[model samples]
Target: MGQLDGLKTVVTGAGGGIGAAIAVAYAEAGAAVTVVDINGAAAEAVAETCRGHGAAADAIQADCGDLAAIDAMLEQAASAMGGIDVIVNNAGVTRHAFILDLTEADWDRMFRVNAKGVFFCMQGAAKRMKAQGSGRIINIASVAGRGYQSSSNAAYAGTKGAVLAMTYLAAHQLGRFNINVNAICPGVTYTEIVSNLLRDRAAERGVTIEQMKQEAEKSIPIRRGNDPEDVAAMAVFLASPGARNITGQGFNVDGGLINS
Candidate 1:
């Protein structure tokens, strides 16, 4: 049997990028999955991909940053999948601006979606998991959380730092219930988000996107950018029974970008 056989999982931001990859990976590992996204079409698309992989899958569209909406989404997801064994809090947003140029609205928006959204989603999922007496929560954080990066905005880093903090707090609070809480700090993964950043940077540098990407890859010790699937593999491992003894830890999958 597959490692995740008989498991039920919910992945937020499942429409694209790392979230989509995680959802697909979980399904491939023999888990029923719920693909949640703010975009209905995107959620459905990912759900279809999961189903195509022979895993039971459903889609739910909701604003993850809103507590009530997240509750509703989880309810719908759990109902569709029968129950939830794992939750991947992978939804996040970034407002790229220098500290001097950043506004209150920018900071607030980043926290709302990146930090607050993850908190409420984890709370709602933990409630269900607590009742069931077992579950796993894997949050997607970033290397920016660990230190300053010239390319990333300060607000984004701050929000990811909050995610790491939440992971630790949640692990402590939920360990009694057999719930595992962990965070993955990914480096420059080759997702649409990074693609867009590369495109913009290329424009700024008067170079092709490919050239910009190559230049960026040099900074990573791995000598190449990460694929979304690399991080997805970590998420799947963390969600499996093998990782039950591990909790409250932030694993960095950033191609050795931050060696701490």
Candidate 2:
């Protein structure tokens, strides 16, 4: 039997990149996964991949930033999967700009999706888990939350900080209910999101994508960038029975990017 045999999981932002990787990982571990994303087609594609791995998976399309939408999605997920044992709040967005150049809209949008969406989704999922008497809620944060001075917009960083704070509060409040809440802070991962950013940077610097990737890898003490599977492996471990004693902790999966 797989590590997650018989577990029902819901993974947000599973349409692509890290989210898609997480969904597949959970499925491979024997969990029935609900792939939720803003993009219906992409979500379905991931679900299909999971199904191909001999796991039961379903896809749902909803704007995670909307409380009502999230509520509906959770309800559907619960109904489809019988009940949700784990929730991976991996949906997020980033807007890169200097503090002075960032608009109020950009700030709000980042908070809405990265912070607000996570808050309500966790709230909804926690409620169900509380009733079930057990659950795992893993929020995806970033090294930006630990205070990065290299680059990235202020808004994106702020939202990640909020995610870590929320994870702590949720873990404390839900511990008594047998619900485990935690946050995973990844450093530089080679996802489509980061790939696009590197591409843009390469263009701006009149360099090739390969050159930009090398520069990014040099910044990490590990001498290489993280793959989506790296983060997914951590998520699987956290959601497994072995991590029952672990909660309210913010794990840094950034290849020694932040020593703390």
Cα lDDT computed for each candidate against the true fold? 0.91, 0.93
Over 126-198, each residue of candidate 2 has an lDDT whose tens digit, in order, gives 9999999999999999998888764467889999999999999999999999999999998888888787788
lDDT of 1 by residue, 1-260 (tens): 77899999999998999999999999999999999999999999999999999999999998888989998999998888777899999998884466798898888888998999999999999999999999999999899889847446888999999999999999999999999999999999888878777887788889999999888888888897789999999999999989999999999998888876
Cand. 1 Cα-lDDT: 0.91
TM-score of 1: 0.97
Q: Give the range where candidate 2 is weakest over 10 consecutive residues by summed lDDT.
A: 146-155
Candidate 2: misplaced stretches above 4 Å? none
TM-score of each: 0.97, 0.98
Q: How much is 219 displaced in model 2, in angstroms? A: 1.5
